[model samples]
Target: MPASAPEAPAPALPRPLIGWRLLALFYDLWPALALWMLASLCFTLGYTIAGHHDPHENIAPLSVLQWALWATCWLLAGLYAVISWRRGGQTLGMRPWRLRVVGADGRPPSWQALCARYAVGTLSLLAAGLGFWWAWIDRDRLAWHDRASGTRMVRNPKP
Candidate 1:
């Protein structure tokens, strides 16, 4: 009998649509919100337990407490996204939409890339979703985070 030829590798999946990414974001927000609420409770409880706070003191624009809370939320959310991406490429939200974030080399992203993605993603959201909209005009359909972090979201084919 003749030897069988080697099997061909499967082709890569297509890039996900902006609308699918947006839907995944909406799903992801629920968990992020829960994490934020927990952080808020801890901050409030600690502030109250410390006691002797000035009742008449007004919050400055650059309040330390506010910044701390914001940092807490940022760190938690970053950990969630980065770890998920590194472990399996799909987050809890992305799984439902069959989305996977892959680096420029078409493999899992490095820690630095994931961090950049999270930071740039924040900027993208704060910019009134201009980053997401940018895909409509981008030749490769990449968003701000995808471009900035050298990562792209691709659709996962069904088994």
Candidate 2:
């Protein structure tokens, strides 16, 4: 008799809308806000220590520094998202909200994918958050970044 082949298990269905992803976004927003505030304070203190006669008069330098700090913060946030998403399949935000970022095949996203997502996300926000709003109207409920990176923010299964 010929050897019988084993059957593969059935694949799981994709997640439906649960609103957890939006909650995760809110959770993540707080930390970013705190970081921004701290960065601004540090810049202000450094400016004062430099003996600028009128700190307000150095608007150009301050603006440039502020932008740099903002970029750095955004990079840090991206790192956080990438690491958390790759390792645990969730960000600090996502964890609390029971959301996770995964590829179409249901695996954690790659670093390049994460970076691409963040870059698109930044651009989306720069365009007045229209990308985020896309989730509301998108058929799959995906944000701009999710669509761009071919990723999904799905409701994580409960452990």
Candidate closest to the true structure, highest lDDT: 1
Candidate 2 on 40-138: residue-level lDDT in tens?
A: 777777877887546665436557776887787887777777787788877777776577788877777888888888899889978988998888898
Clashing pairs in 1: none
Q: After superposing candidate 1, which stretches have Cα over 4 Å from the reference?
A: 1-9, 53-62
Give the Cα error of residue 135 in candidate 2, in Å: 3.0
Prediction-by-prediction clash tally: 0, 0
lDDT string for model 1 (12-126, tens) is: 7798889999999999998888989899778776776677354444334477998999899989988888998899998899999999999988888998998899899999999
- Whole-model lDDT for model 1 versus the true structure? 0.88
Clashes, model 2: 0
